[model samples]
Target chain A: MSTATIALLGQPNSGKSTLFNALTGLKQHVGNWPGKTVEKKEGSFARNGVTYDVADLPGSYSMSANSDEEVITRDFITSGKADVVCILADSSQLERSLFMLADYAGIDAPCFLVLNMEDVAKDQGKTVDVALLEKKLGIPVMMFSATDTKAYDQFYFTLERALKEKSHINVSELEKEYEKIIGYNEIKEQIKGGNISGYTPMWLTVKYLENDKVVSAKLKESLPADAASKIESIGLDANGAIATGECKFKWIDELLEGAVNKTKTGVKLGKLDRIYTHRFWGKPAVVLTVILGLLGSFIPALPIMAVASIFDVLKNVIGDALVSVGCPAFVTGLVCDVVIQSFSYIVKMLGFVFGVTLVFGMLEEVGVMARISYVFDNTMGKLGLQGKSVMPFLVSFGCTMGGAAGARVIDNWGQKVLTIALAWAVPCGAAWAIIPMLSTVFFGAGAPLIIVVLLLVMILHMWITAKIFGRTLVKTEDRCGMIMELPPYHKPKWGALFRYVFGRTKDTFFRVVKVVLIVCLIFYILSYGSGVNDTSILYKVGTAIEPVTKIFGLPWQLFIAFVASSVGKEGAVGVISALYAGGSYGEGFMAAMSGAARAANLNELLLANVSRPEALAFIFAITFNLPCVVALAATYQEIHSVKWTAKIAIYYTVGALILACLAYHVGLMIW
Target chain B: MKKLLELLKDGNSRTPEELARELETTRDDVLRQMDFLEHAGVIRKVPFMNESNGCSTCASCSGCEGGCAAECKGCVPQNAKMNMGTMWEVV
Candidate 1:
């Protein structure tokens, strides 16, 4: 029997093993390659009275020295042990899988191409013309299904033809592609007639352009000293690899253009994606979606808001019962005013938290949030920040502390600080809850308009703040654009979405309840006094600051609430509940209230004491205030610069007060 | 591929589909080019906080190194959304 050795080469999962096993079966022996852990398998089988010895080489992504397997595989191919080489390409995804064939084009060894997984290709509705690919490649090419035993006959026939014909890949077309790359001709000319074995000069030049360390080192060692110096003087460009890679891809595309047919060739965006990706309309479309989403959140929150009001009614009824039962005033106030009232506000905030988390979380689940982020990415650059700054801004809407932490991804220190600086301007979840509640209390049915205006002001505020900070923080640099692989829109898993929403709501409820209760109890105790006395510590302190606070259109009581907001925005609601309801601060204003209104709820009491303009100013102040002390610590933690952190904190504090002053003046003109 | 890089230099973010349309090629082809460019160190994937996947320990360093401080869950949240799209940019 006559024996011919054949080596199998392919990327992992290209059916190299299946083909090896089908041909060799029980005749195979496996062992480790010398000085490496990569597996080596060799076997022999007799077909049609001829014996074939097969060596299954270690699979690698390409013939590069990135890994030991690649080096071992390439070395074995050129070691001259195999008379013929079998190169496998996955027919199902020829665009990607043919990379091995492309890389192997310039090798001097005789080889044949096996378009494996022909069955899989057919199932995917792909029709590949084997004869056309063979003619283009100038080698024996066969459609193959390695998993089918019956296909061995054709595989043997092709192997026999390859060994008999000693066919090598047609490199003329490939070399033409390489010639388009700058410096290719110079490198090729210098390496021509050089002593580097097992590779053509064109192959060595292409690998050198790709910065292939193995190839470059070999050429440098083998070439004459003068010739090596001349090649080095040409100087490799940084983009050489990118250029050569592009050329190889173009060559592959050309080779497959007429050889493969498929129904879908390119990515197609869905309808919503088209609108969200539109150059002129994308920003507007994303903004409108957010507005609608926020509005939609309110619908689900209304039921929870209604449930929270029951706690308010229960507070009044139980307060009357405690008074009738001879309970101490402090005890009654602690139970009804501090505990129940705080719980009521917390529950109401939880309503909005649930709504916001659910709506936004759903958007994320369905992939619209990614488009929103992409839309805002370029806008980040206009602010002298990278596209990634949008993430911190988005996280800020949920929690400013979280936003500050998210800015850690920004490697540039200036941009990191600036990103956190702007993130503070986004009103957090607690502010979101209080703003709409207060707006509803003051503006009634016009709450949505207030939300819209606040959203608009947020944009204006960020733009202005970016201008003020961008000069000092971020320097001018070439801002590279980003490529986003937008996730395809899909139906949200309602179970997971609701679970997350409820989890977030429960977390917010517990956290807010604790802060609100403690803050409310402290303020309520401080404000405890006889009717209209103003002798209580809170009243005395508030009155002392009323003049300064008045400039911002905040009453002493509202100013105290604003200050407490710097602790935690939920504390603002606590201070408001305690000062407005548990004390006699509203006594003088109550005289102007109708007899029926006197017996009205805490919202009515607040409306009686706080004018619309003052309410607007206070709302603006707390919304824009330095988010919370926790956020302050978080900013310091992230930036690790005390001066910058303090700078950002002071900036937000001063900016919030200024915003409040402007809103107050604006409110004075409007109302 | 050079055209793709040039398009990114305009400082506008584009999805792969949009890039494919502008490049007048299939998205798979664009992706292949991106893969090569990225491997060649000409571009990189933009890292995000959620990419941490709630791993409080830094894989790239030892002993915190000012990342994922013990008191802060900000860098990695247990429940951060995982469905955000991928983004890449030139290095």
Candidate 2:
């Protein structure tokens, strides 16, 4: 059997994942490695009649163990399992990649040097002598693209021959280097760990030198106290030893010196990149983007209003058809109020979602978002964040799903989590989707005032929450730093925007729609089935929640709606719609809010609770509450902790309660 | 601590053992509180540790041109002090 259990390792954007996917196809998943939550992926394919188990370790610059991911990569390399490691490098960014490869080379393990993205290197008009590099490094070198199958096939043949004969590589010329490495395998596991686990080697050593308590604790559990203390004493303060390893990035320099010779010169963004990365500019740039993004948000919100109005017309036409069909009164009411209301709400939610997606998609599809990142690099620094990493924070406002999805762009763990948690505080489109509905329904006369107040409260709440959270959740020393490559501005591609929006929206819609529909249907059945005087479930539930609702000037039934809102905020809106269609929102709010107008056969607007100022509080509260079950699942999945997910729920619940209460009063004051 | 930091920042070179001796502590003790020093890139290891064991109690050939540069290969004494280079600073 050909030993093709190739493990790809390198720094970020070295095209490792791309090559892995290309070699094994997209049929894979990010699973755990042994026991840790760090993403582990495995894919298998048979080549030359041998089963090949390919592992795609997390991308990292060195195995020095600064981060958990680095540790994992280091461990995998040091772990005897990998038959042949295909260390991929971006030929353009060889210095850093090769620096990491140096430690691997220090071990002289079986490896294949794959220089990926050859096309990009060529496009840049650079020539690398593959044979010369292979000769110099004393290892097999393969130049190919994961995007191109033809290149992979040629590379595959070379890999096949090398795998059949391990240690065929002769490093006799580098006699001293080889001798230093030959018997050093015994010391591999002696390296402890850092902020994460004990598995990754490079990070462990760095963390050890840095004297990171977390890393040291793990190491102390395994090694002697005297030894640990001695190691801790030698390096610069603590992390100095780790930093030294990275500082001595001579291997990276050598790799660049060996493989790359630039043919053309473009205006590199050295000054521009640095200018934006300044501390003063970082915060202000972020402020401007937020203001501009918010202001422009209205421009993009137009199509949603049109689409929502279209749904309104469609519902009206359906209502007219129902009247013509001479359906029973209850049947007509149920169809119009319950089903129609939910469908229209869905359309409204989709409209706003698609609209926002259109704006962001256009910005990202053409790769100009990096310009926006550049403009605020300095501002990001002032905020103690890596500039241009604000998308994850902003997207959480639209939906935490988007927030989590967008966080994939950020590489730093500390920054990614903080950005995610902070953005979850932002009010989503679903929250604002409550506005038009409220404006049309209850406060038919002063609808505009109520809508304005609700919108104001959402913004104010986000600002306050952001202020408090940004100050607290982030650590004191994590002074934001920006080191981003500003991509060149390009013409916005319409088709790409459409595809980006559709792909995201479709995935999101499918994930959330079923829960919403089921909640809506369940609420409809409960309110209608139980609300016959004192016998109906609605009447019973209202009575049960009456005291609790009274504290917030709401009826008892709203408690049930509030509980379901945790599943998805729209579910709360859906339940309200169901209640109104069941002749309960108007009846129940009056029953709950102390003599609310008693009206029979309410308009679609009235049945939807679209206009009540307090409905604004309820909507926004639900918006900010424990994220929908999907989000809860996501939070649990991403963080890999059920307890943390529950803690997040507790946090949001308290935040929602306080914010909603304040919103209810402030909306009253403003309106 | 302040003087050494300033000197390092100003690009002064001092061996870890000398600094430890000056501080009147073990080499490990001086190295233990090296937080800001490391962050600021003040203290570093000599490039190669090949002769580190040999010179721990003997004459340091690192600073002299007599060995690689000092042109004196093996006549250095065991009790002589060490001379370090930044290359061996954990790299």
Q: Which candidate leads the pack in DockQ?
A: 1
lDDT top scorer: 1
TM-score of model 2 relative to the true fold? 0.50
lDDT of 1 by residue, A1-671 (tens): 78899999998899999999988989999999999999989998998788989999998877767788989998888778889999998999887778788888887789999999999999988999889988998999999999988998898899999999999899888899898877889888989958666777888898888888888888889898888898899888777776777777778888998899887745566789878878899999999999999898888988988998998789777877776788776687678778887788777777888888789888988999999998888889889888888888887887888788788778789989889999999988888878887887788778778788888889898989889988998974746788888887888889878876776777677778888888888888788765454778778888898999999999998999999999999899999988887754655533422122234677777887799889999989998899999889878888899998888888888888888899999999998
Clashing pairs in 1: none
Q: For candidate 2, what is the recovered fraction of reference interface contacts?
A: 0.00
DockQ (C-alpha based) per candidate is 0.48, 0.01
Candidate 2 Cα misplacement greater than 4 A, ranges: A1-304, A307-326, A366-420, A427-474, A478-482, A508-513, A529-535, A543-547, A550-560, A585-604, A607-612, A637-644, B1-91
| TM per candidate | 0.86, 0.50
- Minimum summed lDDT over a 10-residue window in model 1 chain A is located at A589-598
lDDT of 1 at A174: 83
lDDT tens readout by residue for model 2, A574-659: 76666655544444543431212222233443545433546656655676676566666655555565655576677788877776
**Which model scores highest in TM-score?**
1
